[model samples]
Structures are given as structure tokens and as C-alpha cells.
Target: MKRYTDADTYDNKIPSVVTIGTFDGVHIGHKKIIEQLVEAAMQNNLESVILTFFPHPRMVLQKDTNIKLINTIDERIQILEKTGLDNLVIHPFTKAFSRLSAGEYVEKMLVEKLNVRHVIIGYDHRFGRNRNSNIIDLASYGIQNDFTVEEISKQDIDNVAVSSTKIREALLDGDITKANVYLGYNFMLTGKIVRGKELGRTLEYPTANLHIKENYKLIPKKGVYIVKSEIENKTCYGMMNIGNNPTVNGTHQTIETHFFDASFNLYDRKIQIEMLKRIRDEKKFDSVEDLKMAMQQDENFSREYINSIL
Candidate 1:
């Protein structure tokens, strides 16, 4: 798939069938819509395009910084590439861009920049200045702009909304299994490995500290989880802890993983970890010995679960 940083960067000669949204998780419901989009493009002999935005509209317009997303922009790109999309445009969402009139957005971004022959959008999607326009307005604009508009059914839109909300809630609650069911894939945390206090080394469970740069990426609840990562092209299973070290009197939260049998220099190297199952919530053990014993039990449980799956 060809990716453009912005809609203006695209200079497509072929007409396109387009879908516009944040597509946060690209969960099962979102995949259903993307499947339809690809099929529509194939049947119509048009390019399949997805136009998404960064910084999230809420983050820009409302200054709502607490909104966490399922995937970072790069991660979203990674996931979307596996889909059968022809083009992907990530536009910058800014206050000025949000001020555009509905007519201007349709004519310029959709019709001219995208060369859109058809648009697949949500039934209740709103756009333009002050968010006054709806799908009905989009249809009218499509008629004027010489394109067609396809409204994603209300039922499908509802499913998408529910799925997004549920996935976010599941992640925040550390319900990895439930979230993965809705996502159609494991929930991943991709980030750079940074330096920690090296406290885990003394515990005989050396760890790689994962530091995610994106503040908007949602982190699962404070707990230990079964996880897997591809390091040096080899799949490694591990147990990960996402929490502050209560027994050690640590204040800041951390994401630390101890791969079962894999060893390599990981500091400063970036990696992606996919959560497989929730093990247990972080606990404030009575002593370092107790904490070590708990971790040993977690490792045993993780190994058994991993073996069962294998």
C-alpha cells in the first residue's frame, strides 16, 4: 500500500473509492468496513483509499489530552498496511483545518485531492465548521462535486462505536482476552527499550524496560501479563509487568518484560510486544523474597499456558 503523509501529498491519476475516519483500533468492525471498501474499489475499478487524522480531533479541538488511543499513528499504519488498501493518507488535524466549510472539504480534499469517485462514510458522521454537516450534507456535496456517497449503515456504525468503546475499556481494565476478541488480533505495545534501575537483575529476572513515546497510547491496567515479541526474527514468549514496584517503593509506572529464554542487547532498541493473557494484578508483597516467589509462580503459570497453546 502507498502511504501519503497528508491528502495534499497525494497526486492520484486513478479515481478512488474512499473511507474517512480515525480508525483507531482497526478492530473487527472497522475491518468489516475496510473489506467492503476494498470490494467496492475492486468491483468499480477504483483505488481504495483511507483518509485518517493524527493528534485526534478531540485532542486538537477540545484540548482533551486524557483521551488514549488503541494504536499510535505508526502502529495504525502498520496494521492498515496488511489490509488490501491501495492508498493511505494521514492528514494533520488542526484548528485551521477544522474550520473548513463542508463544501470546501468535499471539493478539495475528497474530489480534487483524492480524486474520489465514491465515499464510504458513517451514517452519523459530522464534518465542516462547527460540526454542522452530516451524511445528508455529504451526499449533497457528493452530487455537486461529481462523486457518489455511500453511508455506512446505522447498525454497522453502532457496532463500530461499541467495539471501539469496549476495546478501550477492556484495555484499561486489563482484559486482554476480551479486547483481542473484538480486535481480531492481540493488543500490541510498541516502543523503545529504555534504561530502568536494573532492579530486576538482582531478582534474577532481568527485564527490558519499554518506554512508549506517544503519550496518547492506551496502557493496560497495572498487572502482569503473558506476552510475545519478535526479536531478531525469533518469536519469544515472556511475562510482562506494567506497574510501579510497590515493594521496592518505586513511584513511577513502568513496562518491564523478562523473556523466558531469549537473550540479546535490548537497550535503546525498539520492539513490539503483543499481550496474550492477563496473569495477575501487581501486588505489594511483604518482602523482596515474597515478590520474587510471586514472580516465580507467574513464570510457571505463563510457561504452562504457553505450552498449552503450543
Candidate 2:
């Protein structure tokens, strides 16, 4: 798929079929929209495109807000690419851009620049200054401007509508099992391995620590989990810890993983960990021996869980 940092990059090309949204989590609902978009693009012989923003508008609009994002831009891009879209346009959502009137934005960015032949938007989607523009307004503009406007109905599963906010709530509460049901896949975190205190090695359970990106990603509640770790593009069974080591009097929350029966110097290596199940809450053991024993139990459970699942 072609990725464009700005719509102007496609200035000389014909307008494509475009869908605009934050697509933050790329949840099941977003997948439905993308599927419809691909179908629309195929019918019209137009390139499928996704238009999303950076810094998440809420982060910009509310400086003191406590909004934790579910996916980083890179992660969002990876998920979008999997949707089979032909192009992705990442727009910088600055205050100035937000000030554009609905019509002005469509005229300049969408109509003129992107050559957007068919614009697909959610039925309740809004944009422009104060978000005064709704699908009805956008459809009117499209009618006047000679472009087709497709308003997709909101998707609901089992009578529950899927949304980014609900998914975030589920994740924040450590309900990954529920979140994954909505997300249609396990929630994953990808990062480069970093050096830790080698506590795992000392305990005979060598681990790789991840240095996660600070923005647009949220760790699950402090706990141990069964996970599948990916290194060198290969997946392996593993156990993960997400917490501040209370037993060691350490106060930094981190993601540490131990690949079952696999050992190598993984420092600075990129890895993706797909969280599978929450094992238990982070606890403070009485001593190093106690911690090691607990970790052994965790590892055993993790291996069993992976075996049962696959």
C-alpha cells in the first residue's frame, strides 16, 4: 500500500476513494468500515485511502486531559495496512487545520488536493471548526461539488456498539480478554528490547525488557500475563510482567518477558508481544526465592495456556 504524509503528494493523480477518521484502535468497527471502503474503491476502480490525524485531536484540544491512546501512529499504520487499503494519508491535525470551515476543508484538502472521487464517512462523523459539520452537511457539500458521499452505518455486534472509548476502558481495566473480543485480535505492544537489572537471569529465567514508546500507548494494569513474543519475525511462547517490582523495592513500571526455553542476547532487538491472558496481579514476594518460585508457577501456567490455545 502507498502511504502519503500529505494529500498534496497526490496532487497530480486522480482523486481516490477516501475514508476519514482517527481510526485510533482500528477495532472491529473500523475493520467493517475499511472493508466497505475497499469494496467501494473496487467498484469505482479508485484507490482506497484512509485519512487519519496525528497527536490525537483530544491531546491537542485538552492539554490537561488524561487520554491514553490505544495505538501509536506506527501501530495504527500497521493495522491500517492490514485492512488492504491502497493508500494512507496521515494529516497533521494542528489548531490551524482544525479552524478550517467544513466547506473550506472539503474544497481545498479533499476535493482539490486529494481529488477525492468518493468520500466515505461514518453516519455520525463530524469535522471542521467546532465540529459543526456532520455527515448531512458533508453530503450536501459533496452533492454541490460533484463527488459521491457514502455514509456508513455504525456497526454493532450483539447489540453492543464497538468504539474506541469502550475499548480503552476495557484495556485500562485489564480486561484484555474483553478488549480483544472487540479488537478482533490480541492487543500487542512492539518495541526494542532494552537492558534491565538481569534479575531474571539471576533467577534462571532470562528475560528481555522492552523500552516502549511514551506516547499513544498504554500498558495494561500492573500484572503478569501469558504472551506470545515475536523476535526476528518468529513467535514464541513467553511470560510477561507489567509492573513495578515491589519485592525488589523498584518503582518503575515496565514490560519484561521471558521466552520459554529460548535464550539469546536480545538487547536492543525489536520485539512484538501479543498479550494473551492475565495471569495474576503484581505481588510482592517475601524473598528472591519466593519470587523465583512464583515466576516458575507463572511460566508453567503460561506454557499450559499456550498449549491449550494452539
Candidate 3:
């Protein structure tokens, strides 16, 4: 897929069948729309284009500091690359851009800049300053701009809405199975391995402490989960803990994964963890020995779960 960061410099001879959204998780609902966009483009002999925004419009326009996303911009791009799109444009969302009128957005960005031939959008999609334009307005604009507007059915829109909300709720609730079902893939957390207090080593379960740089990327509920990762070219199953270690009187929350039957020096390596299932809630143990025993049980349960799935 061809990726463009600067839409102003993007010049394409072939008109594009376009869809626009943040596509945060690229969940099943987003995939359906992307599939339609690709199929329509192929049928019409036009290029398929996805116009997405970065820094999410909410972050810019509303100053939404509490907004958490299922995927980072790079992660979104990586997932969308697998959708067989012809072009992907990551437009920078700024306050000035948000102030554009509906007409200006359609004429300048869609018609002049992208050379869009058709737009696949949800029925409830809105744009322009303060989201003043609805799908009807967009279709009207398309009539004047010489492009086509295809409205996704209300059923599909509801599915997309429900799935997006459920996916986030599931992850936050530590329901990895339901989240994965909604997403059509495992929920992933990627981070760099950093040094911890080396407490896991003392328990004979050395773990890699993960440090995610993206503050907007949502972390799952604080608990133990069954996860998988590829290390040394092999898929390894592990149990991960996301919590402050109450047994050790730790002050900060941490994500630590202990891979079963695998050990390596990953202090500086970046790794991606795909969560499979939630094991149990984190709790304060009476003593270090009790915590060690619980860790062993978690490892055993994780191994059984992984084996059963395989």
C-alpha cells in the first residue's frame, strides 16, 4: 500500500474510491467497510483510498486528554496494510483543519486534493466545524462536486458503533475473549522491556517488564492474563501481570510477563504481547511465599489454557 503523509503533495491520476475514519482498532466493522471500499474500487476500475486522521479529532478540537485508543497510529497503519488498500493517507488533524466548512472539506480535500470518485461512509458520519455536516449533507456536496456518496446501512452503522464500544469495554473489563471476538483478532500490547526490581527472579519466574510509550494506547484492566509472544523465532506462552505488587509494597503499576519454559535477556528489546484470556485479579498476598505460590498456579493455568487452544 502507498502511504502519504502530506495530502497537499499527493497527486494521483486515477480517481479514488475513498473511506475516511480514525479506524482505531480496525475491528470487524471497519473491515466490512474497507472490504466494500476495495470491492467497489475494483469493480469501477478505480484506486481504493483510506483517508484517516492522526491525533484524533477529539484530541485536537475538544482537548480530550482522557481519550484512550485501541491502537496507536503506527499500529493502525500496520493493521490496515493487510486490508489490500491501494492508498492510505494519514492526515494531520489540527484545529485549523477542523474549522473548515463542510463545503470546503468536500471541495478542497475530497474533490481537489484526493480526486475522490466515490465515498463509502456511515449514515451517521458527520464532518466540518463542530461536526455540522451529516451523511445527507455529504451526499448533497457530492452531487455538486461530481463524486458519488455511498451510505453504509443503519444496521452496519449500529454494528460498528456497538463493536467499537464493546471492544473497549471488554478490554477494560479484562474480557479478552469477547474483545478479540469483536476485533476479529487478539488485543495486542507492544512495549520495550525495561528493568524492574528483579523480584520475579527471586521467585524463579523471571519476567520482562514492559514500558509502553504511547500514553493514549489503552491498557487492559489490572489483572493477570494469558498472553503469547514470539521470541527467538518461536511462539511462547506466558502469564502477564498488570498491577502494583501489593505483596512487595510497590508504589507504581507495572506490566510483567513470565514466559513458560523460556528465558532470555530482553532488557532492551521491544516486544508485542497478544492477550488471549484473563487469568485472575491481582491481589495482595500474605507473604512472599504466598505470592510465589500464586505465581506458580498462574503459570500452570496459563500453560493448560495455551495447550488447550493449540
Candidate 4:
């Protein structure tokens, strides 16, 4: 699939059937819309285009809103690439871009740059300087520009909204199973492995400390999770802890994964871990031995869960 980083980067050579959104999480509901989008483009003999935004509009327009996204832009791209889209455009969302009027956004970005021949959008989607334009306004603009607008049904839009909300809540509550159900896939955390205090080594369960660069990526509740990752061409299942090593008097939150039955020098390697299930909430144990015992228990629980799936 072709990718354009911004409106300026798009060549406007292909008249396309387009959909636009932040498309966070790329959940099952969002997938349904993309399925329709691809079908529309195929039926109409045009390329299928998805125009998404980064820096999330909220992060730009409302700087104080501490909003964490379900997927980082790179993660979003990784998911969208599998959806049969013909083109993906990730536009940078900035204060200057947000100030475009309804007509200007439609004419400049959609019509001129994307060469959009048809738009498949959610009923609740809003645009323009103040988000003052709705699907109805977009339809009117489509008429003026000689394109068409297909508004996704309220039911579908509501499902998308509810799925997004439920997924976020599930993740925050450490309900990876529930989040994956709504997402139609395991939610992943991708990061580079960095050297951490060798406390895990001393405990006999060495871990690869993960450092995620995107602060806006939503982290699931601090706890233990059963996870899997592809490392050096092998699928490794592991138990991961996302928390501060409180027993060691460590105050910074860290993500560390200890792969079962697998050993590798993973420091400095970038890895993507897909959460399978939530094991348990993080606990503050009485001593290092108690914490070690708890880690053992977590490993047993994770292995059982992994075996059940296998």
C-alpha cells in the first residue's frame, strides 16, 4: 500500500474512495468500516484511501487534556497495512491545520490533495476550525465538489464509539482478554530493550526491560500479563510485569518480560509483545523472598494460561 505523510506529500494522481479519522486502536468496528471502504473502492474502480491524523487533534487543540491513545501512529500503520487499503495518509495534526475552515479543509485536503472522489465517513465525524461541520455539511460540500458522501449508520458509529471506550477501560483495568475481543486482535506494546537494574537476574528470573518512546501510548494497568513476541524468528511466550519494583524501593514504572524456556541476549533489540491475558495485579510484598515467590506464582499462572491456549 502507498503511504503519504501529509497532504503536501500526496500526489493527487488517483481519484479515490476515502475514509478519514484518527482510527485509534483499529478495533473490529473500525475494521468493518474499512471493509466497506475497500469494497466501495473496488466496486467503483477507484483506490481505497484512509486519511488519518497524528499528534492526535486533542494533543494539539486541547493541550491540557492528558489523552493517551490506544495505538501509536506506527502501531496504527502496522494494523492498517493488513486491511487491504490501497493508500494510507497520516497527516500531522497541528494548531495551524486545525484552524482551516470547513470549506477549506474539504477543498484543500480532501478534494485537491487526496483527489477524493467519494468519502465514507462516520455520522458523528466533525471537522473544520471549531469542529462545527458535521456529516451533513460534508455531504453538501461533496455535492459542490462533484464527489459523493456515504455516512456510516448511527448503529455502526455507536458501536465504534462504544468499542473504543470499552477497549480503553478494559486496558486501564488490565482486562486484556476483553480488550482483545473488541479489538479482534491482541493489543501490543512495542519497545526497545534497555538494561535495567539486574534485580531480576538476582531473583533467578532475568527480564528484558522495555522502553517505549511514545509517552502517548496507553499502558495497561500496572500488573502481570501473559504475553508473546516474535524474537529472532522464534515465537516466545513470556510473563511481563508493568510496575515499579516496589520491593526494591524502586519508584519508576518499568515493563519487563521474562520469556519461559527461552534465552537470548535481547538488550538493545526492539520487540513487540502481544498481551494474551492479565495474570494478576501488582503487589507490594513483605520481602525480596516474598516478591520472588509471587513471581513464581505469576509464572505458573501464565504457563497454565499459555498451555490452555496451545
Best by TM-score: 1
Q: Candidate 2 — which residues are off by over 4 angstroms?
A: 154-161
lDDT per residue as tens, model 4, 112-163? 9888999999888899989999999999999999899998999999999999
Decreasing lDDT order of the candidates: 1, 4, 3, 2
Which consecutive 10 residues in model 3 have the weakest lDDT in total?
A: 4-13
Model 3 ranges off by over 4 Å: none
Error of 4 at 55 (Å): 0.9
Question: Against the hidden reference, what TM-scores do the models get?
Answer: 0.99, 0.93, 0.97, 0.97
Off by over 4 Å in 4: none
Off by over 4 Å in 1: none
Total clashing pairs for each candidate: 0, 1, 0, 0
Q: For candidate 3, what is the lDDT? A: 0.91
Taken over the whole model, the C-alpha lDDT of each candidate is 0.95, 0.82, 0.91, 0.92
Kindly list the per-residue Cα lDDT of model 3 for residues 1-310, writing each as its tens digit: 9999957766678998999888889999999999999999999999999998888888987798899999988878888999989999888999889889988999889999899989999888999988988999998888898899998999998988889999999999999999999999899999899999989989998999999999899999999999999888999889999999999999999999998888678999989999999999999999999999999898888888888999
Give the per-residue lDDT digits (tens) of candidate 2, residues 1-310.
7787877776437558888877777888778878988999898888788888777788787773566778878888888878888888888878888899998999988888778889987777888899998988888888988888886766532222446767888877888888888888889888989988888878998888989865558778889988886656577888888888899888788789888877667888777788889889999999989999999999888878888988
Model 1, position 222, has a per-residue lDDT of 98
Report lDDT (Cα) of residue 13, candidate 3. Answer: 87
